[model samples]
Target chain A: MKKWSLITLVGADQAGIVAQVTQILAADDCELGETSMVRMGGSFSMMLRVRHDDMDLGALLKGICESLNLHLHVDEDVASNCEETDPDVNITVYGADRSGIVAEVTAILADAGLNIIDLETAVAGTADKPIYIMTIEGQALQGVDALTEAAKKISKGIELNIVPIQTLRA
Target chain B: MTVLDILQYPDERLKQSSKTVEIFDQTLKDFVTDLEETRLAGPGAVGIAAPQVGCARRLVIVDVSQLKKPVDNHGYLLLINPEITKWQGMEKGREGCLSVPDYTGNVIRAESIRIRFQNIEGEWIEFDSGGYEARAIQHELDHLDGMLFLDRLVSRRSDLFTRKTYKK
Candidate 1:
């Protein structure tokens, strides 16, 4: 079976993390492709896309990740199986920070056969006047304004905005 | 005359400052028509700035009545030599450019604004607006000053794509 893998390294920040990660990838006979590493809020988060050969792939990867006290998720050849990115439709939701905001929106989009392509959510300002901002991308199954009117009703109590966005071609 | 083509980036016309709408005459009318036409010719465009159409004039046209925001918008206003008199609220939003097609960037601007501008007839008009209408006016006005929404972006932190939604 052809194996295309995505390895995510998320844990506490420390030295040798990157080196250890590369070592693990090399040992797994995987070809490393693109990578993004960030240290924020006192935690190190790194993600890499890789292609791996067969022979005890999943269990082997789990062992290495467990030893390092990290969580690892491996998807085999998913990109080659389905390489197309989800079409993005930009939508904004903001209100007083509260629970279930993401679930409410995602559920509505989910019901409409739309996938949450990407999401950026933040709670800003002090706790007294905390502001919640969520920017999301979802794929439209049919056409324009398909989810808009329904969103308008669900969005009344909350501030919702939608705009079509096309990302940079890389 | 024909509708002026909306100049894309890397074009020198887009980099230069637009001329002021000195006289709101037939020539100016043609420019406004071209701006509207160019705006209509593309994907749903909320606004256009004069510099985008190769005219370095401080003129812009905006209409966000079609947006889903709940607020008052004055339909389409052909602004010649417009100015912002009052502004409030702060927001970081995702914005796209008619000049720079196929890319959307993040931009932050005042949430509301009171603006003064000259109509196509050279008569002065003023407006107090908020929500998407206010955002469209700000985006268009930025064009009047040789600015693209890209210039206002805080960072590449957020990009808008209708289809390619996120970094995976």
Candidate 2:
């Protein structure tokens, strides 16, 4: 059995967060395969994906965050499970950039009982001309038309577009 | 009608810039035939480029009237040594590639576009289009630049993939 690893960082904008996180991540015999980091106003946020054959990474990450005086939380990854079932689908949300877009949209998805397998989100444009783009790959729950209905709700704040996973046939 | 053998990822020819045609010669005619034939043979086919058939040249053919899309467009359009001059509107779409088989990605594109291209007779012509027609134009033009739909993929989230369906 393979264990899942997640590394999350949050703290005042500073230099040592990565140096410290990598130290703990390395001890887990984990390999860092994916990462993204950014500075938002006065704080720094980072997300990373590592692989380990151990137990929950959430508890380990929480202790690290506490010792560093930063706020952090981690949860079990869901995308890996979804990938095992259907391997094709794309869902995205786009709109005016704003705070809590991820929280709000993720909440909506969870409430609808949809399983979010993989998600990538970013704020493009400028501070004065901001645009938000959030992409989630998942399957709709029973009695849910994930592509159209979810898009309509997300669009109330941001434009939404949904399409089936792409395939090339010759 | 010849169905194109889809080129796959990391094929060096796919990354090399395409060569521009100096004239609408015999080679150009052959490309049109191949492109058109490939378009017809594909399942839910709409358009194809010279490079998709393994020829790196400035030629492509498109016919989208059969698919469900935005507007009424020409039945079939064959273009040579083409170039786009202007466009309007902004849209993000999910586009797949014959070369990068079995995967789809998000692509931001123009809503309408003005373009110029030569016919098989060497007569150059220009036109304007919107909706699905514009998408076809952009798709074909990207082929001329040696670009596949994969380059425009914003993220891996939209990657719809299938088990290896086509071989070189």
Candidate 2, A1-170: lDDT as tens digits: 55555567678887787888778878877677657777676788888767776576766667768777777666455243312333244556667888878887777666666677678776788879899887777666632354355444553666555554432222
Write the residue-wise lDDT of candidate 1 on A74-168 in tens digits: 65565744343545466777788778888887777666656676676777779798888787766766443666655744644577766654331
Best by lDDT: 1
lDDT (tens digit, per residue) of candidate 2 on B17-126: 67877876786677677678776776665777787777887877777666543356876787777888998877655577667655555676687888898888988999
Candidate 1 segments whose C-alpha is farther than 4 A from its true place: A1-37, A40-43, A46-114, A119-170, B66-71, B154-168
Question: Candidate 2: which stretches are off by over 4 Å?
Answer: A1-9, A13-43, A51-170, B22-30, B37-45, B101-106, B148-168
Deviation in Å, model 1, residue A143 alpha carbon: 12
Candidate 2 chain B: 10-residue stretch with minimal lDDT: B159-168
lDDT (tens digit, per residue) of candidate 1 on B1-168: 355677889787776777777886888787777778877776777788878867778988887666543347788787888899999987655677767766666677787899998888989988798766777888887766667777777653354322222211
Each model's chain A TM-score: 0.69, 0.49
- Angstrom error of the Cα, residue A88, model 2: value is 14
